[model samples]
Structures are given as structure tokens and as C-alpha cells.
Target: MPEVVFPLDSTRSFTDQSLVGHNRWHPDIPAQVHVRPGDSFRVHAREWFDGAIRNDDSADDIRDAPLNSVHVLSGPIAVEGARPGDLLIVDILDVGPIPQEDSGPLAGQGWGYTGIFATQNGGGFLTEQFPDAYKVVWDFSGQVATSRHVPHVSFPGLVHPGLMGTAPSADLLSRWNAREGALIATDPDRVPPLALPPQPDSAILGTLSGSEFDRVAAEAARTAPPRENGGNQDIKNLSKGTRVFYPVFVDGANLSLGDLHFSQGDGEITFCGAIEMGGFIDLHVDLIRGGMDTYGVAENAIFMPGTTDPRFEQWLAFSGTSVTLDGEQRYLDSHLSYQRACLHAIDYLTTFGWTPEQAYMILGAAPIEGRLSGVVDIPNSCATVYLPTSIFDVDIRPSAAGPVRIDPGQGVPRSSF
Candidate 1:
């Protein structure tokens, strides 16, 4: 039988720091997730706002609500056989509704999932969209609630730890808190081979270029008012049924999480207007050993059918800079570099111990697609080039077994979109 985990067995106090008082914990699972059709697991979860507001709540509630202790996650359950260096594979068996007979919002059908970036409401892409956006504020006062404007989608915000293992301390808080910035692990098997960095004379910043990063930074600087947390770029992942990857910086992972969204559109342009709730969730975590791929990822936590509809897959490219066109501009200069990243993945996987065909098929099935989850917030730029599961030609199988579990619930973690 498959192992199952739950939230802190208490109604008010939980061992999970990320979800301690709110009853949410983020337990990261391995990326090499493998399971049969019958495999099942239960997760502990909490509302995005931690019982902040109620259905009858109004916009006024949002404006003055204390924007703290919102968006709770649950679980850090480790898989039985996972290790320190193997890939963790998550099999998304299925998703269903939690039967709640309470007087609050979830009258039978309620799960959370959103795209808004910023944690605090007030100003965001959702301003005009959600009438209550202006009043939105964080209120851990009572049962989790949000300002009255967001439409209830009733979808669980399936979150996964970005990186699984413990990360290196970011005492060096550069521009943003890299340490607390949801670290995810990757499989050496999935990463493309190490290629030369783009030449200064190479393509204009579109993806992975000095120019691109500059633009991104400039955008962050331009928008987002520097507050305690990393500005409006809220990207809450690591929720129920979500798998994330991270590098192993410490023997035990001291993971933190935040960026909880009640509901959001694809592009997190708006601050997820008043998206909060309260409840408990559960998860199963595993560790990866002897694997390190270079999608800039240390490990991968697989979430399936996928935590989201568009599940996670490794890709060589994510985003590119919006460089101006030259008089003699050519597609080769612009697209070639990205294409190479995709092609080179085959070699990268081989170095990690995969055969050419294995790597090729992996990429083939999971169309190395691009991601743009963080285009709206502080950065005016757009795009997150990535790989999708549809890229592969073969029916992929989980590679790891007997997962080693890693359940570390510490700190009030926050994420940037």
C-alpha cells in the first residue's frame, strides 16, 4: 500500500511552520514519481487567507485587512524510498472534492487554484477585474476569508516545493531573497548538457542573456514597491498534490513557502484579489540522490495529471529578452540559441547516465515548452520557456523507487512570481 501523510494533527497548531497556525505544510515529493492507476494519497491543506473573511464579506474588508499570515500550505511528506540524490517522480493519480458540511464557503465543492501574483491585494491586474480588489487585505483574524470581489472557482491551489532539498543560506540578500525564493531540485538526467554562455555579441536579451536579466531587473525596480516581502511577484506553489524540486544544501531541508493565491488567471497580472481560505492538507515527499540536471534545477518534484492542467516538464528554454531588431536581424541570431538549449538537453541527460534515446524520448514526450507564469508583476517582460509532457514520444515511466521522505516545515515562506 502507498504511504499517506496528513496536516499537523491539531485543529489550531501544526508542526508545519509554513502552515503552522494555519494548518498548511508543504512536503516536497521526488520528481521521478512512479505509480499505478490505483495509487492514492491524502493531503492536508489550509485556506489562502486562513479563515480571514467569509462569503458575505465585502470590499471594505479587503482595504483594511491586515496582509499577513495568509495563504497556508500543507504537507512535506517524504516518499518511502526517496534518497538524497535520486529524482522524485510524482504521479497525479486524480483530483476530487472534499466533502465539508460546515456553514462556510465549501458547501461540498471547494478546491483552490489561482494565477494572481502579489499576496496583498489593493493594486494588481485584478484591480478592475475584481471589484473587491481595492479592499483586499490579509486577515488571519477569523476563519480564512478574502475581500468580496473574486469569483469562486472552487479549485485547490495545488502547490509543489520548487526545489526539494535544503538550499544554501542566502545571507546575501541580493535584490531579492534567493534563499527563501522557493528552491526546486532537478534531475541530472533531465538537464541538457552544459553549453557555453551567450556571447556579449550574441542575440539580444530574450532568454538567458545579460540584456534579458537587466530588463527583468529594471522591470522589477520600475514596478513593485519594496515592502517586507518580495513585492507583487507572488507565485504560490507547493500546495496539495503539488511536487517541487530543490538542491540539497543542508542535510535536512529547511524549506519555507508563501505566495498563496486563491484564484488567478494564467498571467499573474493582477494581485490575486482576495484569494484566501483556511483548512488542512496532506502530501508525500521523497528525496533525490545521484542526479543533477541543468535546467538550473537541482531536483524535480513531479505533480500530476499535474498540479495544474499544464503539468511541469523540464525545458532548455524559459524566457527571452525583448531585444530590439537590427537592420540585418536574423532568426538564427534570435532563435538559434534557444533551439540549441533544447537540443543540448539530450547530451546533458546522457552525462547524468541516460542513453541518447532515453533523453530524446523524454524531451520528445514533454514538449520542451515555455512558461510565462511571472510576466505581469514587477517585470514588464513576459515568457517562461519550458518543456511540457507532450514533447515525448514514449510512454514515460518513473525511474526511482522506495522513496526517502523529507518533511521540513519551517519559516513563513514567500515566493516571487
Candidate 2:
């Protein structure tokens, strides 16, 4: 076992930890721990919601989930000698659920959840169809996940951290706030507002107090969107053995991460999607001085994905165009096309007795593939979603026999505002 630099107690709240972490992104959030560039260490991360979300069969928690306090990252662990204009190399050595404990109220104790957020809370990619909140709890056995709510399916989890990033420089953080705040000002009262602005209501900056805490909280950027600093990118391929290069904007390169997922499909389509869990991540850090400018990687993270991602020889695929369900056409909108593809998959799954929510959960939590298959084809961008055929208990491939129906047990739990 590596040296556990930041340890977390499964039964305690994130704020009660020995070395507290922040929920928002701010360079001023002092580094609670320090590691040398060549150090190999362990970090215990709380699930995004801390332990507020439960492992039971209800979507009430999802509906009322605290949006303000999220992503609950584990560090601003400064790397010694890491400086501006450099690139920090992060190697994910290992990651998994809580060590040694299998059963507990906390997530990642052999179980985790996938949730579709309510439109009023945080609308998902398919929120137009799934307006209400829905929840599915999946049990982990070795590397696979099986759900009672979404039955007749089991698949290997592609466990990885859903959020990880280096701290933003003051100028970069100002730019983030300016752009995101401008977007929010357009629809300040919009339900599930355009973009989350910095709010001091639930800000958690490490070890800061007095007016400094309030000032920093008001100026910090929310961890909901991925920015130049790499917050909440949600890339599922960043699993074990992946090497990532992040541009450093501040001295010491304060890096933080959390929101581990047992598995997630491409895009994490559902808003609160992925099999969200609390876990430990083993990391090894190094530096590439001046590599940011040396490689023209000035913003965002670039990575060589791990070779150990789950493999499936055959897949059932569905594709969709940029045309809306109501027949409105949009030009070159890959995001809209992907949403339509996922909706098409949900509709097809309903033919086999799985509820739409169950199908959406599968797409969010399984190792499914999503691709932009036709972006250059004129007005209509085309996106395709591929599901591993083996994950389903019944034959899902198109055949002369048509689709085979399987019993969907108990269905996903639901709650609405």
C-alpha cells in the first residue's frame, strides 16, 4: 500500500475529515497536503455528495440532491517544484471502492448508484423525456455491476475518477467566472439555469476563515463544467494506468480529484449519471517543465488512455440525426444528435420490457460507446450509441426472430418536484 496522504472515514462527513478538501475551484484554497513530483501516494475521496445520497431504492434523494455542494474533491495536493508554464503528469496507478469494507451506508461499499436528475434540479441529456428524477442502485461483485432496478443485465465496470484538475490561476479563474456568469445572467431565473455561478451558500475552501473565506467563496468557480483547469471533465477512459498531462497555471501545481465512478458510458448522459461511489485512488506524479508550450497544450488535459478498458467484440448500435423529436432540424449539433441517439436506444429497449429509465441508467452506467459518426454531412450531424450485446441477458441483436422480451424487475425508482 502506498502512503495514504489524505485519509477519509466512511462513516464521517466530508467536512469532518482530518484534512478537509474544497468543493469549488480556487487557487487560494491552500494545499492541505504536499507531495514531491516523484511521490506515489493514495487519496481517499468522498462521493460527490459526500454521503448525502443513499444506496436505497428511492429517487427522492436525487430530486433533492444538494447541487451547490458537489464534486467534493480530495485535494489541492501541491507538488514540490511544479511551476507555471509546466505540465503536470498524473499517472493513475489504481482506483477502486473503499478498501477492506464491503457493506456500509456509504456509497462504494460494494454498491453505488446511477441517477437521472429532475428537470428542476439539474436536467439531464434526456430530461425532455425523463423529466422526473430516477435512481438505480447497482451491486458490485468483483468487477461487474448488476442492478435490481435494471434487471436482466450485468456488465464490467470501467472504474475511474469523474473529476480531477489542477488549481486555476487567478486570471484563469476570473475568465471562468466572467464567461459563466455572463451565460447565467441571460437566464438567471431559468430552471436548471444555463450555468452555475459562484455561490457562497455551500462553498468549502480548505482552512480559510473570516472575510477571506467569503471573498474567495464569492469568486470561486463551480466544479460543474470542465474548463482550462480540467474540472469535472467526466472522461471514463481515464482508468487505471492512464497518463494525463495538465498545464500548470500556478506554482506547486495544486491538484485535486473526486467523484469516482464504478462505471460510466461515454458522455455520462444522465446528469447525475455513472455508478457514483466513494473510493481510494493511487497516483504517481511527475513534471514536464515547459511541456505546456513545448507541446502546444496550453489548455485542457490531454491523455493516453489506459490499455485495460473493458472489451466487447460485438455491439448493438443506434444512430440519430440532429433533427428534433418534433421534426425541427438543427445544423451540425453533435450534442443534440447524441441525445437523439440515446433516446432511440431507450425506445428500442422498451420493446424488450425495460423501462425508459432503466435503459437510460444502462447507457449512463455501462461501458457503452458514443460516437459522432457523421459530422461533415451537411445540416444533420449524426451520432451513434453502441451497447455491448453481451451485457444483456437476452439477445438484443436484430434477427429474424425480432426482439426477445425479458422481465424488468421492480423498475427504477422515481421522484418528481
Candidate 3:
């Protein structure tokens, strides 16, 4: 075991931890832990919700989830001697569900959850089709996850961190706030809002209080979306053995991480997609000393993905063009095309006795592949989603025999707006 630099007790609230971490991104949030280059350490991360989500059947928690306090990250662990313009190299040595103990109230205690947010709250990619909140609980045995809500399916967990990044400098943070705030101002009343802005409510900056805490809280950036600083990229490919280079903006290269997922597909189609978990990650950190400028790595993280991801040779694919469900055509929109492809998959799955919600959960939690198949095809771009046929208990391939129906047990728990 690496040195337990930041230990967490699963039973306690995230704020009650010995060395507290922040929920928002700000350089001023003091680093509670420090390490030198070439250090191998262990970090215990709370689930993004800090245990606000549960392991039960009800979707009430998902419907009324606290949107303000989120992505409760584990650090601003200052790397000694790390300076601006340096590239911070982080090697994800290992990651998985909560260590040792299993079977508890939390999400990652031998189980985890995948959720679809109601459109009124945190809407997802296909929120138009799924306006209600839904929840699916999956049990972990070894490395595979099996959900009782959507039965007759099981797949290997592609455990990884969904949020990891360094603290943003004051100038960089200002730019983030300016752009995101402007976007929000455009649609301030939009349900689920265009983008989350800095709110003093539920802002948890480590140790700071009084007027200083209020000042930083009002200016800090939310951890909802990925930015130039690599806040919440949610890339499932960043598993063990992956080496990531993050451009250092602040002194000490204050890096923080959390929102661990046992498995997630590309895009994480559902809002609370992925098998959300509280877990421990083994990391080895080193500095690249002026490598940011040397390599022309200006922004965002560049990572060499690990080679040990789950392998699948055969896939049942679905493709969709850039057209709305209501028959309106959009030009060269890959995001819209991918949404269509996912909807096509969900419709196809319903023929095999799975609900649209069940199918959506599978696409979010499984190791499904989503790709841009065509972008240069004039007015319409084409996107594709591929599902590993082996993950299902029955042969999902198209045949003269037609789709085989799998019993969807109990169905997904739902809560409507």
C-alpha cells in the first residue's frame, strides 16, 4: 500500500473528514496535504455526492439531489517545488470501490447506482425522452456489475475517476466565471439552467471562514463541467496505468480529484450516469518542469489511456444522422447526432423487453462505444453507438428469429417532476 496521504471514513460526512477537501475549484482553497515529486500515495475519495445518493430502490434521492454541493473532490494536494508553466504528470496506479468493507448504505459498498436526472433538475443528453428521474442499483461481484432493476445483463466494471484537476489561478478562474456566467445570463431562467454559476450557498472551501470564505465562495467555479483546467471530463478511459499531463496554473500545482465511477460508457448519456462510487485511488505524481510550454500543451489534459480496459470484439451498432426526433434537420451537429444514435439504441432495446430507462442505464454504465462516424457528410453528421453483445444474457444480434425478450425485473425506480 502507498502512504495513506488523505484518508476518508465512509461513515462520516465529507465535511467531517480529518483533512477536509473543497467542492468548488479555487486556487485560494488551501492545500491540506502536500507531497514531493516522485511520490506514490493513496487517496480515499468520497462519491461525488458525498453519500447524498443511496443504495436503495427509490429515485426520490435522484429527483431531489443537491445540485449545488457536488463533485466533492479530495484534494488540492500541493506538489512541492511545482510551479506555473510546469506540466503535472499523474499516473493512476489503481482505483476501485470502497476498500475492504462491503454492503452498506453508501453507493460503493458492494453496490453503486446509475441515475437519470429529471429535466427540471440536472437534465441529461436524452432528457427530452426521459423527463423523469430514474434510478438503477447495481451489485458488484469481483469486477462485474449486475443490476436487478435491469436483469439478464452483466458487464465488467471499468473503474475510473470522473473528476480530477488542478486548482485554477485567479485569472484562469476569472475567465471561466466570465464565459460561463455570460452563457448563464443568456438563459438564466432555463430549467436545469444553461450552466451552473458560483453560489455562496453550500460552498465548502477547506478551513476558510467568515468574510474570506464568502469572498472565495462567490468567485469559485462549479465542478459540473470539464474546462481548460480539466475539472470534470468524465472520460472512462482514464483507468489504472493511465498517465495524464495537466498544465499547472497555480503554484504547488494544487491537484484535486473525486467522483469515482466503477464503470461508465462514452458521454455518460445519463446525468448521473456511471456506477457512482466512493473509492480509493493509488497515484504516483511527478512534475514535468516547463514541459507545458516545451510541449505546447496550452490547456485541457492530455492523457495516455491505460491498456487494461475490458475488451470486446463483437458489437451491435446503431447509427443516427443529425436530425431531430420531430423531423427537423440540423447541420453538422455531432452532439445531436450522438443523441439520436442513443435514442435509436434505446428504441431497439425496447423490442427485447427492456424499458427505455433500462436501456439508457445500460448505455451509461456499460463499456459501450460512442463515436463520430461521419462529420464531413455535408449538412448532416453521423454518429454511432455500439454495445458489446456479450454483456447481455441472450444473443442480441439481428436474426430471422427476431429480438429475444429478456425479463426486466422490477423495472427502474422512478420519480417524476
Candidate 4:
């Protein structure tokens, strides 16, 4: 039986016995599945709930939580004979949805990312009051689709084991043992269970951006504005057709993916429940050199069109907010807030003499659409910075106009034009 290496992460608490890196031989093994350049394969991933509950169908189920709620991704089928330099080519073939044939308790069959059934202020910014936190429930006897205000924005959870490396550097923080139900199957043999160590925190990451974006996220987290326009979901549009690229790391990327989403609102405010189940995924990996080529660097960066990027962004934006509430939201006017943010970001790079295409092309590759650090957290409606770490390869700085160090301590962040 040709095997796949489960992408192993060691950051938080994942358990070995948990379905972390195990693979279920679809219909056949690696050899039987013929892969061509354009050929696609539809792999039906198990739901995050793994079909544990019996006919559960209410948001309360998600709120109440189930036994295996921690999240466990499946896979690690070693390609028939994929090698180190070779890339994994995938195309999001199509979604083979698990119809309401056996509906989930918390997630309704008609549950889309937005609309009456959408998750509320999740981890996103909201002008709504905590006491008045609200979510409009939808009534659909079947599928989670709708023709309402939302565009047909579909995408894959495209999750991976997260830790696919050999300690790139000795000093690097090890994320192999992240506390969850996962195990690094070194030889296809069952690994022993291990206990978690005390004291910690965790999440996904991005390429090094010299901390500009990182600081921006931090500053936003610390700041808070009294009221804001809306709670933008800031979700990555992973509809049917989109190929995500990741620079090759460990052997075959030691990939693992869970947190699959049916639909996720932007800013991920409500979080990744729709993202909880697996999606039929297709991928094509390529080895691109010089990580980020032209996108300039900012401490905290986001590309134009907020809440949209391949790499996930996080922020302290949702403090004291009822992030725990589902279906809470409201939209507003100020369309330019997003436009201004994008324009400001592009202009920041253009100041370095790079054309918009240069900026766009470079940014298109390694963009790390960062989390929205809430200016609402602190005192100002401080705009969130769109920092893509890939900017480091471009060699520009916020203080490039002069040698200045910017941060929350620096009062306010200004573009050094």
C-alpha cells in the first residue's frame, strides 16, 4: 500500500490517536490514480464533525461543541513516488457535498457564509452592541447555497499538516507538537501518544515581512474604535477555480488539511466553522525562487481589497466583542474605506518606483492577507494595514522616506512619502 505522509504540526495540542495524519485510501492507491497536468481528482474529505452527532441541525450544536471538536485533518498518502523537487499538482475539481441526507446538528443544510444564517461578528469588527448581537436564521430544507446578496464565492479549506519541515533553522519555533489530535507518522507505524507542555498560544503563519505587518496587526489589536461600519467577513474567495501555491518545504509538503469550509464570511469574524468540513480539493505546487519578488514591505501589510488573501490574517480586533455569538452582522456605506486601504498600500510600494503591475504581480504570489488588528480595540478607527510578508524580497520600508521605526509606541503609523 503506497502511503502519504500526513502533514504534522507540533505547535498546539493535537493527539496521535486523533485522525490528524491518517489517510483513508479513497477508491484505490497512488499508482491507480493517474495524474496529468490538467487532469483533476476530487477527494471527498470527512466533515470536521466526522459524522459524530445523529441528525443535529442547529447553530447551538457548534456552540455547545461535540467530543472531537478540537479538529482533526485526514491524509498523508505518500504519492506513488513523488520526490523532493517534484511539486504536487492539484485543481479544485468540484465539491461532492454531503447532502442533508444526513444533516449536521449545528450547521443547517441551507447555511451559507452570509445572510440570515451567517455567523455573526465572529472575530470581526462590529458596530453592533454586545447586548444586541444578532444573527438572522435561514430556512432551507437542503443545500447550503443561496442567490442573495452574496456572489457565488466558493473555495477550498486547502488545509495542510502545517508543519512540513526539518527545522529550517535551529532557533525556529517548533510547531510539530501543536496540541490537537495529530501524530507524525515517521514510518507508517502508529506513534505513541504524548502529553502537552504548559504555557502557550498558536495559529498559522506567513513569510518574513520584517515585522511591519506584524506590528500593524499588534497595533490594531491594542487600539479600539467606539463604533464602526460593519463586520466584514474578510474571507478568501476559494470558489471552484483557484490554484493556491506554496513554496516547497518538507518532503511533499508533509501536508494536512482540515478546517474545510462550505462558506466563510470575510474577516473570518465568525471564524471557520463552514471551514470546519473538508472540500473536494485540487492543488498544483511550484518551486518559485526569492519568495516575494516585487511587493514592497510594511511592518503590517495587507493587499488591496481587505479581507482577501491566500494566507490567513488575524488580529486583536475582536476583544470584548461577542465573538462567541453567531449570525451577528450589519453592512454600511463608506465603500472607500476598503478602496483607500488598497490604494494606500499600492502607493506605499509605488513610492519605491515600482509600477502597479510590478507591485501587483509580486504581491499576487506571496501575499499574506493579515488579520485585522482592531483600531476599535484601542481608541481610533485606525485603519488596518495590508501587509504581505512577501514584501521583504522587494526591499522597501515605511520609513524608507527616512530611517524611522514605526510601532504602537510611535503614536500613529504614517506612510513615509
lDDT of each: 0.31, 0.92, 0.92, 0.28
Candidate 1 lDDT tens digits, 181-277: 3221223222121111112221111112355444332322111221221122333333344544444333244332223333332223334322333
Residue 56, model 2: Cα distance from true site in angstroms: 1.3
- Score candidate 2 by TM-score against the native: 0.99
lDDT of 3 at 354: 96
lDDT head-to-head 1 vs 3, winner? 3
> Candidate 2 at 232: error in angstroms?
0.5
For model 3, residues 101-218, the per-residue Cα lDDT tens digits are: 7889887889999999999998898988899999999999999999989999999989999999999999999999999999999989998789999988999898899999999999
**Higher-lDDT candidate among 3 and 4?**
3
Model 4 global lDDT (CA atoms, 0 to 1): 0.28
lDDT of 4 by residue, 1-417 (tens): 112122222222233322333211111111212233333343334444443322222334333333223233344323333333333333333333333323433322333222111122121122121111112222232333322211111122322211111111111112222322143233333211122221112211221123543432222110011001110112345434444332222333233344345444333322222333333344433332323233221111122222322453332111122122352332321222332343355456555554432222222212224333333432222234345332243334445365222121111111110
For residue 167, model 1's alpha carbon misses the true position, in angstroms, by 6.1
- Among all windows of 10 consecutive residues in model 1, the one with the lowest summed lDDT is 23-32
Model 4: CA > 4 A from native: 1-39, 52-60, 66-69, 77-90, 99-234, 272-279, 282-417
Total clashes in model 1, counting residue pairs 3 or more apart in sequence or in different chains: 135
